[model samples]
Target chain A: AQRVTQPEKLLSVFKGAPVELKCNYSYSGSPELFWYVQYSRQRLQLLLRHISRESIKGFTADLNKGETSFHLKKPFAQEEDSAMYYCAPPDSWGKLQFGAGTQVVVTP
Target chain B: EAGVTQSPTHLIKTRGQQATLRCSPISGHTSVYWYQQALGLGLQFLLWYDEGEERNRGNFPPRFSGRQFPNYSSELNVNALELEDSTLYLCASSLGVGSNQPQHFGDGTRLSIL
Candidate 1:
């Protein structure tokens, strides 16, 4: 069974500190990984994808197939970056499965 | 263009009652996917409809069903709702053209079962 695992339920970091949210996926085929974020009182939106290789909101994720991981990273966390981040399943024809999200709280 | 839209942002129902949630995909999107976002469950794909047909479905009971119309609008019906059925039901839409087009989401409908 294909699954995406977000090991951290809540990750706390001080403002201006670096943040990394870990994600691991189990899939046999070439996987297309994505990071989705939901800010408070807002709809869930796509942050970035492995294929695009573009960084959004100062966050970037690299797909490491050998390690079966696609970890989201931000060099400097901002207070506004506090939000719920969800990692999606491997690319498929239809909707992608999601892992239990990780909530990041940036404190002063 | 407007994003995916869901109706009745908040709903309250009792046990044994049925709940119907509606979703309108983006103007050109041909695929609609329904997901249940419950506490600690993340997001569970419920159903996927494309070209007015049920293409894929998650592991859910028969009581959970839905269909897509010619306009690509979709609805999810939860029958005999239980307390555990309380969740945020989200609807997302994708172009269904090329692969890897990320699904755009709407602010989900929050269903509260008592």
Candidate 2:
């Protein structure tokens, strides 16, 4: 079984402050990690994936096997960045396990 | 192309009643996935369908079942509904099964069991 954990239920940061949303997972095999974001009144969508190894909208997440973590990070936060963030395993295997999600509230 | 779509944006049912939800995958996509977002449970995989076949299912019971059609559309049926069964059922689609392609989600069908 695959499980994902997002320790924080709500995360708040002021404008221009660096932010990080923590995520951890447990899987026996090589894990496929992804970060999805849901903006206000918008459907959920991919923010950035570990395999892609690229930043999206100033957000990036690194998959660490040793620590079993894939924490999302942003150099500077903006008010528009407020949304729900989910860490998940691959949807292909039907596990698609997602963390409880972190509600990010970026304040100006 | 249009993103994934789900029918019956909202539904209401009573205990022991059954509910059916539908989904249409994106053009050129052949995979559809069902997930449930309860009040506190977060998002959970319910089932996966690809090419008109049941490729996989989550830890749900037999009461939660679904099938796929040749057009890549899908249906999810929940029987013996309980109050806890009320939730937002989301449908997602990708190119196919076992790929790295990100799943595109629908707005979701909100089911309320009384």
Which predicted model would earn the best TM-score?
Answer: 1
Docking level of model 2: medium
What would the per-residue lDDT of candidate 2 be over residues B19-96, giving only the tens digit for each residue? 999999899989898999876667888998888989888889899999998888999999999998888999999888
TM-score, cand. 2 vs. native: 0.92
Looking at model 1, how many pairs of residues clash?
0
In model 2, what is the error at residue A103, expressed in angstroms? 1.0
Clashing pairs in 2: none
Q: Report clashes for each candidate as comma-separated counts.
A: 0, 0
Standalone chain B TM-score for every prediction: 0.96, 0.96
Error of 1 at B93 (Å): 0.4
Tens-digit lDDT string for candidate 2 (A77-103): 999999999987653363356799999
Candidate 1: segments with Cα more than 4 A from true spot: A91-94, B97-99
Highest DockQ among the candidates is held by which one? 1
Checking candidate 1 for backbone clashes, the offending pairs are none
Q: For residue A15, what is the lDDT in candidate 2? A: 93
